[model samples]
Every structure is written in structure tokens, then in C-alpha cells.
Target: MKKPQRSTAIFLLILSALLLVAMATFFYLKTQRQSAKTSPTKPALTVSTAALEQSLLPQRLSANGAIWPWQEAVIGSEAGGLRLTEVRVNVGDQVRKGQILATFAIESVQAEVAQAQASLAEAQANALDAAGNAEKARSLQRSGALSEQQINQFQTAEKTASARMLSARAMLEVQQVKLKQTRLLAPDDGVISARNATLGAVVGAGSELFRMIRGGRLEWRAEVTSSELSRIKTGMSVNLLAANGLPIKGKVRMIAPTVDPQTRLALVYVDLPLQAGAPNDPAAIRAGMFASGEFEMGKTMGLTAAQQSVLVRDGFSYVYTLGEDGHARQLKVQTGRRFGERIEIREGLAPGAVLVTSGAGFLNDGDLVRVVNPPMPPTASTAANPVPTKPQP
Candidate 1:
């Protein structure tokens, strides 16, 4: 009975200590909850807000290809078995139509012309004598100064001599043409792209002597998929970058009717401006150079936002919009054509919604953001009168 009384006293003391501790802990938790509710949450970032606005954006199609000549004209020799005497032009030389490109040693050809002329003169002298003889024979026919057979013989001789003279004249004309062929003349206005003629080199007839780009024109052969080819039309405006990064302006000249079998891509021929292909122009481009270009297909209206407002994450585009609760809500969006500093929002966005224009990449979902106005640009007057600085020691 004494041990049971001692144990009950100890249990009562422990229960009283536990009750006192539980009351103090409950009051401490109440104080902490009240303090947490009254504290201000710090913002994750400060950003500017912008709303989607309707703007006219250009519709464009991009393709990559190589620069080429609008039409390459091969210049070959017409004279056969002649030695090339002189080369008047080199590659990259600009030439005009009817300009003399090269000249051959004309001594031999001129001698042939002289020989033909002499032969023609002799034939003419013989023909004149034959005509006099025929007339004399016909006049003496009735007087019996010549027999009928003799008169016929004289007339036949006159006809034969006349035929020989006519043949000689034709030979002279042929020789004159060969003489003119000795001087190779340019057939069109162009820039020389190649030259095969060598001084003192014997070249065969119809052999290539030079190659030229007709009209001094250059074209961009844009390679486009079969699907993209359908949207292109003649006279469409094109902007291109040369291999050297020179900007070129052009117009669509034509589209190839057939697609390449291996690549299945069609060719779009764009006629570049004359200045862009002239040899003397500093911005001139060359053939066989890879380039990129875009065809302008006019403009259409679209909802655009500042390009910075959109961000790409995991290969998908996203934008942050401010909510009434003062936190960022990350929303996925579909993007399209891009203009100067704005981008087209194709889908997944509603008009008139405000978006974080800058510092969006630093924020995450449910991040508190402080909306602020974008800083204004410096005026010309302020830029001209910059702040003066003191010399450093």
C-alpha cells in the first residue's frame, strides 16, 4: 500500500509538468504565425510590362542557295586553223557588245584576200573580152564573117567566162569573211568570267575562247523545297546576303518548272541588281558562292510583343504574364515571324494580356515580380553634352 501511494504521487507530478509545457509551446506557435502573416514578401525580379499590339508584319519565305549568272554565254572562235595572235582582255574585264576581244595575225588572211581579189580581177577582164567577142560574132552572123558553128562557139565561150567570173567573186567574199573572223568580237555586254585564248596559240574552229555573263547580270539560284516553291511568284522582292556578307537586293526572275530528282528541291532564279554583279562594284558577288535570301510576300496583321518577353526553354517557347496575385504565371506560346524588336505570337496567348517584357528569364512560376516602367532613351542633346570627367592621378 505504501509503494502504490508513492507511484500515484510521481504520476501526478509528471502530468502537471506536461500540461505546463504544452501551454507554453501553443503560445509560442501563435506568436510565430502572427509574425509570418504580417511580414512583406520580397520580389524575385523587377520587370517592365507590355501588352500585345496589332502590327503589320511582313510575310517572308527563306531559302538558301548559291549565286550564279543570270545567263552564261560561251564565246568561241568561228575561224578554224588560225593562230591566236593577241588577247585583248582578261578574266573579270567588263566588255560591251561589238567590242573587239582579241586579234589574230592578219598577214596570212590578208594575203589570201589579195590573191582572191587578183583572181576576181582576171576573171572580170576575161569576161569583158568574152562579151565583146559574142557581140561581134552575133553581128557578123548574117554577113557570113563567121559560120553558124563559129558564132555558137563564141557565145558558149562568153557564157563559160561569165560563170568563172561569178565563181571568183563568191570566192573573194568568202575570203573577206574569213579575214573579219580573225578579230574576235564580243557579242553582248558582259563581264569575262573565263579566258582560254593564248597569244601565239593555234586554236581550232568553234573552240571556246572565253566565257561571259550576259548583260553583266548575276542571279541567285535559291533552293527551295517543293512545298515552298508553290508560294513563290515572278517579280517577288528578295533580299539576299552574299558569301562575303554583302547585302543584295533582287527580284524573282523565274522558278524552275522541274524539281531536282536527287534533292527534290526546285530552283528560284532571282535577278540581282546590276550594281551587285558588276566587276567594278565593291559589293559585287560571284558565281558558285553560297548565300541566304528571303522572298517578301507582302504583309499581314499580327499580335506582336517585345522579343525579350518570349523565351525558349526545353525547345518550347514560353512567356510570363503578371497575375492579380502579384506573381508570374508561365504560359507556353507558339511563335512565328519576327520583326525588328517584336515577335509574332501565333497561339496560346490572348489579346490585351500584359506580359513581362524584360528580366523574364530570371523568374520562375509563382515568382513575385515588381512591374516598372522601361527607361527612356537619351536625347541627342544629352548625348552631345556628356558628363565631364576629372583626370585621374
Candidate 2:
């Protein structure tokens, strides 16, 4: 009987311990459930949105190219084997037509001219004497006083002297032409772009000494793909982003006849506006600068949105549109030419659909979002309200 009582007491102690542990576990689980119910969730993200609208936008084709002179004139020496004595013009010099650009050594040419003149004078005197002798020979020809052989010899001498005079006169004219060639003159009014002529340097004929941009005219040669070439035509307007990040206006002058075999691109010539206003105007565009521009093809109606609203991912374009559930829905869109801060939407978006404009980059498909209204700027009346002059001491 004592052993049975001891076992019963031990069993009661074990049961009581188990019961206490079960109650403790139940209370702990209850507390956890209550805490989960009371805790707050993440707040929705605020974003700016806009409604897509259809509007008339200009159709444009974009291309990149380098600015170049319309015509580059090569200035060179016309006389060979002459030492350059003076180089009057330098690179970047503005020169007029017929302006002397350089001078060659004229001392040797002057000496040749003098020699030619002396020879010509001697020939004239000899020719005069020969004419008198020929006249005497003709007078004696009818008389027997002069033999036939002697008359023939005198006539031949006269002809020989006359021919020598003619040769000397031709030599003198040749020397005069050489003297004039010792100076290099500008062929047209232009700005010098390059110069290689050096003082005292002997240059050959036809060697380039300077390069000029004719009439200070610059042109933009935009290269476009072969397929886009047909859409562009002469007389279309163009707007280019210049080297200095300023806009330049131009017009399409011509289209290339053939396309490049390697790049499959054709050249579109655009004539840039001439520099106007102050010479130091910050808007001056220069040659050899790489610029990007757009050709205005025409106008058409297209759905448009802010540039930031469109996102590019994996070579595809998308826009996050707002839905009735206050969530963003990622919709793929086909984009076209961009104008200013707005871009054209060719497809996948309908007019009057609300789109996330500001924070679309951070949102994902079906992500919760809160549309935030833009803050109104302070008015002049509010700005003029002073705080009662702060009751100064």
C-alpha cells in the first residue's frame, strides 16, 4: 500500500508539470498572434503621374555627323624652284580675293628679265641693219652688178636676222611672265584653315601651302541609314545640337546619290546659319565638331508622355500605368522620335490612360503606389506677408 501511494504521488507531480508547460505555450502563442495583428505594414510609395494624351507632334529623323566647310580651297605655289621670301598670311587669317599671300625670291627672275631685254635690243638693231641690206640686195637684183648667188645669200641673211629678232622678243615675254609668277595671291575671299608655307623654304609648283574655307561657310554632313534617306528631302528644316550644347538651325541642302557600302549610310548635307550679331557671340558653331540633329519630316498625331515616364529594359521600352487598385501596371510601349521633354508613343498605350511620371523607375508591376499632387508654388501675396516685423527691441 505504501509503494502504491508513492507511485500515485509521482504520477500527480508529472501530470501537474506537463499541464503547466502546456498553459505557458498557449499563452506565448496567443501573445504572438496579437502582436502580429497590431503591427503596421509598409506605407505606399508616393509618385507623380500624368494622363496620356494625343497631340500633333513633328515627325523627325535623327542623325549624327561632323561639321565641315562647304568648300575647302587649296592655296599653292604656281612657280617651282623659287625660295619663299615672305609669308604674309597665317592660319586663321581672313583674306580677300587677290590678296598677296606669299612672295617668292624675285632677284633671279629680275636678272633674267634684264638679260632678255638686252638681247631683245641687240636683235632689234641687227634686224634694222638687215632690212637695209635686204633693200639694197633687191635693188641690185635686176642689175648684172650683183651675181645671182650673192643676191640669194644677202636675202637669206636678212631672213635669218628677222627670225632671230622674233625669237628674242618671245624670250623677253616669257621672262616677264615668270616675274609675275613670283607672287602668290588669294583666289577668293575666305578664312585660312591651314598653312604650311615657311619663309625662305623652296617649294615646288602645285605644292599646297594653305587651305581656306571659302566664304567662311560651314556645313553639317549628317549620315543617315540608307532606309531613312528617302524620308528626308531637300529644303527640310533641321535643328542641331552644336558643340557648345546650343541649338543651331539649318536646312537640308542635298542628299547623297549613293549609299556607303560598308556603313549603309547616306550623307545628308545641311547648311548651317551664318554667324550673326557680335563676333564674340557664344552661339558660334565651328567646323569639325560632331553634332547630333533632327530633320523635320512633317507633323502627325501621336500619343505622348514625359520622357521620364518611359523606361527601357532588356532592349524594350515600357511605361508604368496606374490602375484602379492604386497599383502600377508595367505596359510595354513602342517609342518614336522624342521632342523636347516629351516622347512619342507609337503603340501599347491608349489616350487618356494615367501614367506614373516621376517615380516610375522605382516601381515594379502591380506595386502599390500613392499618387502625390504637385505642391502649389507660393503666391506673391503670401510672399509679401511679413511676420509683423518681429516686435524688435
lDDT value, candidate 1, whole model? 0.92
Candidates' C-alpha lDDT: 0.92, 0.88
lDDT of 1 by residue, 133-166 (tens): 9999999999998899999999999999999999
Give the per-residue lDDT of model 2 (tens digit) for 1-393: 899999999999999999999999999999999988898445368999888877789878889999999899998888889999999988777889999999999999999999999999999898889888888988988887888888888888888889999999999999999898898999998888899999989999899999998888889999999888889989999999977787888999999999999999999999987672112465667778889999988899888899999999999999998878788899999999777888998899877888899988988898888888697777898779844566678
TM-scores for all candidates: the values are: 0.88, 0.70
Highest-TM-score candidate: 1
* RMSD in angstroms between candidate 1 and the native structure over all alpha carbons: 5.6
Tally clashes: model 2: 0
Q: Which candidate is the best by lDDT?
A: 1
